[model samples]
Target: MPLWNVYHPVGAYTAQQKQEFAADVTAFYAHRGLPKFYVVTIFHEIPESSFLIGGTPSGTAVRIMIDHIAHHAPDPAARQQIDDSLTRLLAPHTRDRGLYCEFHIDETPRDLWMINGLRPPASGSEAEHLWVRENQPVPY
Candidate 1:
């Protein structure tokens, strides 16, 4: 699962933009064979007073924290590909909007993750494909 946490100044994005961004993020993973339900994007709107940069309030910065559990880049090339894709995905939402953005990814051990009390199936396994089709957890 790729859990994306987006932190931005309040009013930086409209409801429609948030929905669109979430869909875009989900599609990025779905294209790579992850179940649609496995991609979760959460938006955190911070008040200007509460969001600080270098000990000063900053209204133009956005931060993203991504936790990858079901999959991880297997090598440096794969990691670069992921990073490039993410950069492209974020351009319109951040750079195009004149927002300074910072993001980092943390890969957690797959064995340490679960959904509906069940471990996700191996990548590309029949069970995993079924979950992708069903868009939910099922006993494998």
Candidate 2:
């Protein structure tokens, strides 16, 4: 599974935008072969004064931290692709506002990550499908 945490300065995005943002992130993974249910997105709005860039308080900052199993992106090229995609998806919210947007990915070895008291299966594998079907008892 992949989890995305979007941390943005308060007032930078409207409620609708936040919803759209999450949807876009989810879609990104789905397009990359991940099942929709396996993607989780969380939004955190922080006070503008609480964030800094170059040691100066920032009013327009959006940071997305994504965690996933190792080899998900696989290589630098793939990682850049993801970064570029995120930059494009976030441009509307950051570019015009002179905001800073960053997408950081953290990959952990699958053997070391566990969910529902069990280790997850390989990405997009049949076992993963079974895992999703078994553990995802409720629809998102």
Candidate 3:
């Protein structure tokens, strides 16, 4: 079972938005036999104070978290495409709410996940763990 705890800052989240987002994730995970347990949290903080990069205050645009049993996915491009798709699906609902919120994704590995009494896909590659926080700086 891959569990993800998602945090949307105070101004960025609404109860309805959170529920819709969770539904999207659940459907995605259902396709692969991996259960994506969605947990949404709301917090209030300045970006500079809430996020840090290398112990320095980070000017992050968003924050998210994921926890699971641990697994892997190898295909980077495909994984990215999937993520992009998700962002697109969830973005409009948020952006329209007068929020400059960015979409953040987090995931955990699944080794022996028991979903509906079925084991999940063992693992894949590094790509499985790859997710882009859109507000991040370029990795030049």
Query: What are the C-alpha RMSDs, in order, of all predicted structures?
Result: 0.8, 3.4, 11.6
Error of 1 at 120 (Å): 0.6
Ranking by lDDT: 1, 2, 3
The Cα local distance difference test for each model comes to 0.95, 0.74, 0.48
Model 1: how far residue 80 lies from native, Å = 1.2
Candidate 3 lDDT tens digits, 27-136? 66555543243222334445566655468764434444444354444578866876676567556644555444454444444543544454433344222222112211
Better of 1 and 3 by lDDT: 1
Candidate 2: the clashing residue pairs are none
State the displacement of the C-alpha of residue 111, model 2, in Å, after optimal TM-score superposition. 1.5
Flag regions of model 3 displaced more than 4 Å: 35-61, 67-71, 101-140
Off by over 4 Å in 2: 96-98, 130-140
lDDT of 1 by residue, 79-135 (tens): 999999999999999989999999999999999998989989999899999999999
Our tally of clashes for model 2 stands at 0
Candidate 1's C-alpha runs over 4 A off are none
Please name the candidate that would achieve the greatest lDDT relative to the true structure.
1
- Least accurate stretch of 10 residues (summed lDDT) in model 1? 111-120
Which has the better TM-score: candidate 1, or candidate 3?
1
